[model samples]
Target: MAAKKKIRSPELEEGHLCYICGKEIHGDHVYIKTRRRSELHIHFECMPGKQQVN
Candidate 1:
């Protein structure tokens, strides 16, 4: 059997533009920001993954 892929968020489901490189990724992507306290909108490489290291 083939593995099922994760679904993207609704905000980016249709399509998302990256802030850093202006890249576009479809499903199973991630969204990230340089600063945690940043109020500015950021969406680089389409989106970021759920895996976070702190």
Candidate 2:
């Protein structure tokens, strides 16, 4: 079976920006590591439709 991407919800920092909306993550957020090992910081509300971690 194929491996799944690593998804985690970490504490949001003061200047963390959302990868989707390009705005600062104010409240809660998620962190994901892609197959290519790229780290993405995304907002909870702006997460991709099919890739909601929570």
Report the number of the highest-TM-score candidate: 2
Predicted structure 1: lDDT: 0.52
- List candidate 2 stretches off by more than 4 Å: 1-14, 50-54
- lDDT (Cα, tens digit) per residue for candidate 1, span 25-46: 4554444455666422334332
The CA lDDT of each predicted structure is: 0.52, 0.79
What TM-score would candidate 1 get against the native?
0.28
Q: In model 1, what are the clashing residue pairs, if there are any?
A: 30-47, 30-48, 30-49, 31-47, 31-48
